[model samples]
Target: MVSFGIWGLIPPVLTITLAFITKDVMVSLFLGILSGTLIVAGGNPIIAILNLTDMLAGSLNDGWNIRIFLFCALLGGLVGMLSKTGSARAFGRWAADKLNSPKTSLLMAWFCGLVIFIDDYFNSLAVGTVMRPITDKNNVPRAQLAYILDSTAAPVCILVPISSWVITVMSIVKGSEGFSSLGISEFEFFMRSVPFNIYAILTLIMVLTLILTGRNFGPMAKSIKYAKETGKLYNEDYGPAPGEIEVEGEQNSSKARPMDMLFPILVLIASAVILFPMTTYLGAIDGESITSLGAAMGSMSLGDAFNNTDASMALFYAVIFTLLITYIYYTVRKLFTIKSASDAIGDGIKSMVPALIILTMAWTIGSVIKSSPEDGGLGLAAYLSEVVVGGGFPIALIPVIAFALSALISFSTGTSWGTFAIMIPIVMPIVVGLAQAKGLMDGAMLNSVLISISAVLGGSVFGDHASPISDTTILSSTGAGCPHLEHVATQMPYAITCAVCAFIGFLIGGIFLNLFVAWLAALGAFVLALVFLPRIYKA
Candidate 1:
């Protein structure tokens, strides 16, 4: 059953199709889960119920993965509250007033996307929502806005160190004996791999190039022209209609201030960066490494004097602090009434219900996949590695193949995290085996590991950016209110352009430089964008 690719995908495909047809993702995901449960349990009615229970329980117990969904839900609530408070509108007004040029606005969108790399979902949602109105006001199309958000999410995370995705992948890698014996720490190896992550580097370059060149073509070109001519992107009315802004904008309103918006966002980021590293540095942590929550927990424990009671509960503490601080600031600043805060939280949780359901189904399928090695499911990595090793394939092609595999699975599954979870574990072993066979030292083996991981991440993000059913795609479309298919159609070409060029760059980097250099060299795609963009738009 695990050997059947279609078997693994059937339930998810049916669910996604249903969602698209009904325009209800929640229903689609639920039905998908149900279908999987029924199929796996073989129609034993009681056992089917039991399987569903176990799936739900297992997902809840999955710790970080589940916690992330919860965190996203809370953030969603914050967004909702902020929306109702008109904080987003105020920021839009400010952005519109400050950044009057389309090029600058586009650059700002790209920059914000790059900087907000802590979590992909947050990147997709927050950045998309905040930037959409501003972009539309500046005559940027919704398809363009979706492209910006979709491009930044996985690509930036693949490059960053402290991201949740990195931590998760690192944990999985450390579980492998081959990885452990390599004597290369995960962070060190991850950094080395950064330059080899061709997809990320190239995407970043593409973003900058797009901003500088202002070239639009295909669906994007059409969308941009339509936006400029009709003055409607995603059918949205940007700001108050002309003279209406003079009337409505002048009312003495008690909406949330810009400070109210910036404070919580800053706190979330600071807590993750400062607290995460400090705790790890202080040595109160134990694991593969100290996570962001662990660091926050360590601070609370050591700072509390004698008891050190809060040490084990760092994540809980950090989450509470974030939620409370965000609520208090929003409430006191009149961003929302107290009742609104509570309602926002509830609404936020509700918004995340679909994600939670999907997460569980994904985990269930992942659990089945993880059990695959036991049943001779060496996975695609094993098969590809075997072919590459036997055929004496050039090292230059490793990143390309790995990236393509990641992209393929991610696009099919509509989830980057799932792609990472599936591919990294399998790819690490292949890298180690190949290194040993080639008489490479620990250092060379580590290089392979880094390169492989980079490829996986790059591919995963590339797929997510283009996949019609991807969560980020949905979120991007929802944020911009662009038709999902339209966004997907418009974005795929640009993403592919980066992918092909990045693949070439990766091959060159692998042949000449080490993995990191190869990945870094892919950043040259920005230059490619500069050279070709004018022609694209001109056409």
Candidate 2:
């Protein structure tokens, strides 16, 4: 294997630059993988091809990676089943009558996005499918519905404690070097970082502000104006709306109720919440050799309990349990025949094929970067740590730098999870090293690490929100029946507005090292930008 040192940056840089130029994520990522393999192979074309194949196989073979892929597919199937049963249609009709105003329609969509926070993919499609008709009836622009869908999807999932996002992030943190020595459990660290996740918090707040105030700016303002006055949801240049994306239920069934849709979703959420704690408690008892359940529970903190828990396993079981219950309920009520329900499940999994491909490629490339010398991969994280330690960059500014870099990368790649997989292993070690060098460990150092970690997550979501090629972005457009480009164009200003405020917030947090003060400054910036920026668009 060759040692490229700083030259290791070429692969990702090439990936990002090419993605922006071509606007094709799959091609961009494949080329990036090939380039990395070439470098590792010392410019041998044949060897590079062999190395790339091995990398892909290895990524797919990992237990955690395979489980996550399955989780996404199964969740998609559950959503499809809900749509097939007429649950979504009933709920939409029920919601439309209750939400008679445009503002209420937007709020309801936003609320549904919040409610289905288990996974972002599910959030985008489910919210869009359920709320599009309602929003359309109220003359809410498709662009606006897309915005609400995109905003609530990843942003809400990243903030919520019980989500797959939290589980993945915790696992990454636990596996990081020097993490165990810090004397903090992964869950505790994750909880601490929540307050520092400024970008997500600010974005959600901005969504509510815009919804309540009924203010629009930039391209979105134009779209809303056109929709309101001319009843045209799309720009004149874009094609006709795709047949409204909807799920049709059995025409013969008169028994379909809104509860048919809601019950399964509520069960899914409850199972996740309940199973997480139960699994954690059980694991603690078994692993720690505690004599009694009460003593085991009392022996550890909440974070400790979570650290001992098998989150992926618990989530997998929860989803499976929910699906089984849903299928049984539908069959028992005669809403769907067994064969029909089976077909719906198959169709649902099929719907996620494109997303699955993207995710697999993303994971494969991440493996390419993280692989060791013996595996013929560049250890980017170690190289970065060496540079930061030896280089003259200020430690305090790390959070700001991290936030900007993550945003740029995610925007270019159109995948926040991929960005996280690449950034966390690299960023966390550097933060911990810097803190140690300064003789800081618990309070100040831990806070710095948390701020930087949260910045990476928040910036990624912000960038994904702005990227036209992002999976969630595309899904949101599909869900809302809006032309994809129209959604991207209209949502850009709102995302940028929040991102700018988040950037400034990270700077304040880095310099002041105070989460509360930084949050206040960021909130102030958001209000000022929201109030003033629209005037320029008006002109």
TM-score of each: 0.72, 0.88
Q: State the lDDT of candidate 1 residue by residue for 1-539, as single tens digits.
A: 32333344455456546644664544555565566565556557676667666765775575555555455456556545544555544555666678877788888778878866755666776666667768867778777877888888877876775454565455445444356667755555665677677777777777777777666666677778777788877533223211111101122134645455466657766665444444344445555455455564655643332222212123333445677888777666655667766776777567656655554555554443333434322233344445556666566566667787777767766767656655665566566666767877766666666776777888878877777877777777766667777787778878888887677665665565375566455656546665666576542
In terms of lDDT, which candidate is strongest? 2
* Poorest 10 consecutive residues by lDDT, candidate 1: 240-249
Residue 72, candidate 1: C-alpha displacement in angstroms: 5.4
127-187: candidate 2 lDDT, tens digit per residue: 7888988888888989899999999988998988656566667656665555665777676
| lDDT score for residue 89 of model 2 | 66
On a 0 to 100 scale, what is the lDDT of residue 352 in model 1? 58
Clashing residue pairs in candidate 2 are: none
lDDT (Cα) of model 1: 0.61
Give per-residue lDDT, candidate 2, residue 401.
91
Q: Compute the lDDT of residue 280 as modeled in candidate 1.
A: 44
